[model samples]
Target: QLEPLPALTPEFLCVLNDVCVKCYTDFAPDELEVSVREHILQDLEGFVRRQFSGARLRLFGSSKNGFGFRQSDLDICMVLDGQDTMDDIDCITIIESLARLLKKHPDLKNILPITTAKVPIVKFYHVRTGLEGDISLYNTLALHNTHLLATYGAFDNRVKILCYVMKVFAKVCDIGDASRGSLSSYAYTLMVLFFLQQRNPPVIPVLQEIYDAQKKPEVLVDGWNVYFYDDLKTLPSRWSEYGGNTESVGELWLGLLRFYTEDFDFREHVICIRQRARLTTFNKQWTSKYIVIEDPFDLNHNLGAGLSRKMTNFIMKAFINGRTVFGTPIKVLSPIYPNQVE
Candidate 1:
């Protein structure tokens, strides 16, 4: 018979809460910073509009999802109104044109036009705010993803708090950059959401599962059904069966760490928050990846597809270390250092 894990004592919970609160305060961007970023985006939008008529820019990722940290890069998506598909408009041509346009702006520095990249984007730095941002054309999937994350964050403040804390922790341990064969902050947030959804008396409902049979909302994005109950007001009545989870942010944070470190089988399972059930990696044909996280909209896109074996081990080690620090009891104060000799 397996042994049940010990519960976190109240004393330890208090300490974890204090640390999380401090981390949240220290890492979260202030209102002034947000205001400045919005202004910069507005200016960029105006410039884009001058060249591409009917083109509109929208913010996504951490900037709009409420999970951004101080000085985090902003993600913007540009949607050209008349273009139904990528074939309709040459993405590389438009991106190159936009890059050249942005280069004219003195405030926009280090402008790089990456047309051949997977998600072709125009990366640039804003001189005034010293903030970096990438503009991708017709990335509507990212827009939906941002909305999904925002909804989750709004459902429980703890979700946002834990996400911010985890992001900072990943950055500190140097395992958060996706370009370097690790997971992105967005992927980390999904992992946190998956853990929360699987918790006993789950902190959140599988939003995609909450809807009436006759009146279900249909949202088909990029050939995938990305439908989910987004209205916060109606969610309470729809998900009345599951009462509020009384777990503290600290407890959930620790639980998240423990879940990733001990319970989750990265090779066999797929992290899918869209449904309230386990998805197998074999079924998805994602068995080869060390960490498989299904993209909510683009089912075929594994967020962790870029992770190599060594990077997976590094990430797992970080998780183990995190669990050890947050899941176990620690001495509040070490023995006082010996008095220095005069």
Candidate 2:
């Protein structure tokens, strides 16, 4: 016999329930959507099976995460079971076969765009319906750790750390406390990119070098203190550090924007608000400050929760209708950015 689940607090669960409702309502792919998705998956699997026996498929992102909405697209990764010499031509054959089958269903074909890459990646998108999916072919060695990509032949630790951190942070943001709505995963990704780009001389060049070498590259955090010594001879002790008092986290965030992006205006895009609100006994402060909002929504006035008088005043002056960023028109569905990460 099993025991019943414990009842949750009405306050927390209510917000979560609202998120679940909005999530499904906004993005849950419908029956017809599922049909199309399954069709693509089955056809690709069949094609691969015929050519390369014992291959397996794994799906990731929104489709596998259960956050998928009605119109959500598909993301699939194909793992090869054994050592098989598959050239770019072989990968194309697999994709072309599937594309031919999809051609029979005009609706699916119209919305789906299929393109293959050197690493056996077939990206499909349906422009009309916004349904998209991907087919990735990978060897067992690379498949063992999907978090870090062995792109062009190198294993990078930064990718694994960044992905892991982003995932955890995004999960924290998803709670959607009315006081803190939710930060979209896409927005969080942009923030990560911005931070990485701020690294002196840029990190992408280092990644490119590592990729060409086909080996894992060790990253050293500049301006950090050495906390631990992993080994004496091979790699130096890892260091950790932070910006001193004169510079706040807000300042660091601003530096990231100014250093990396070519055309974005940091001040025009972000608003910092410190609010005084009755804090929960469990929380950190009796009064706290959050990013609260960004881009179009003034953190102070438009937002409903934990609003301070100063925030209300600041918002009125800073925000106006019809402001745009990166060519996307601004709308305050939430505090986070709506479109692609810059």
lDDT of 2 by residue, 38-117 (tens): 66667656655665577676655445433344554466777567645455666667666645554554445442324433
Residue pair clashes in candidate 1: none
RMSD of each: 3.8, 18.3
TM-score of each: 0.92, 0.34
* Residue 166, model 2: Cα distance from true site in angstroms: 12
Best by lDDT: 1
Candidate lDDT (C-alpha), each: 0.84, 0.38
lDDT for model 1: 0.84
Candidate 2 to truth, TM: 0.34
Write model 1 residue lDDT over 52-133, tens digit each, in one string: 8788888899998998877899899998887766742488888889999989988889999887778899999988788899
